[model samples]
Target: MAGVTAAVSARLKADEARRPGFYAAGSGPLPQVRGSTLPVMELALQITLIVTSVLVVLLVLLHVQRRILLTMTGLASALRNSG
Candidate 1:
């Protein structure tokens, strides 16, 4: 069984070797960068967070303003009707 597996593996490797090398890197796992991070990705995420926060704040303000307006109008009509 081991011999069959090794033969198959060798044949596959040989076939791969004969093919045009279109791939740039080796067929193994990429090197890990434990302490490193992409600066551009971080900047983009931060900007997105800031924009999302601003949009949320604006939406909340608009919602609260509309509610307040509705309440005030209702109160004014009630006061006029009562007095």
Candidate 2:
């Protein structure tokens, strides 16, 4: 087993020696990295996705229910027709 390994290595060494340049020749394409690719990290990830989507819509309008936020801002039909 050892002998086989030695033979393989020897062959590889011989092959390398025969080669004039780029013996291992970057076996593939991977050499393009010039980055600070920034518009301030794309404006800081669009201002952290607009401040976490306006802090998750102000924490879901501070957890809903003021009569479902005055029936979604129609001011619950003018405060239920002014009592």
Candidate 3:
């Protein structure tokens, strides 16, 4: 095993000295790139939030209107009974 290791090391050293430009040495491989859909994801989230906020506001306004109508009806009844 040690003899095989020595042979491989010697071979590698000889190869490295002989052909320095064999494996595209200095420039390296072209860079790989990947893109994410973060902007689309954020836009979707913002749209959802705006829609939910508008729905909540509409529901709150509906509740307030219902309460106001009830109060007005009660006041009208009280006035009719007193008069």
**What are the root-mean-square deviations of the candidates from the true structure over C-alphas?**
6.6, 9.5, 12.7
Cα RMSD, model 2:
9.5
In order of lDDT, best first, we have 1, 3, 2
Per-residue accuracy of model 3 over 1-83 as CA lDDT, tens digit each: 99999898777766765774343234466334356566679999999999999999999999999999999999999999999
TM match of model 1 to true structure: 0.53
Query: Candidate 2 clashing pairs?
Result: none
Which regions of candidate 2 deviate over 4 angstroms? Answer: 22-83
Q: What TM-score would each prediction reach against the true structure?
A: 0.53, 0.27, 0.56
33-52 in candidate 2: lDDT tens per residue? 46645667899999999999
The numbered model that scores best in TM-score is 3
Most accurate candidate by lDDT: 1
Q: How far does residue 19 in candidate 3 sit from its true spot (Å)? A: 31
Error of 3 at 44 (Å): 0.4
Error of 1 at 51 (Å): 0.4
Alpha-carbon shift of residue 81 in model 2 (angstroms): 33
lDDT of each: 0.81, 0.74, 0.80
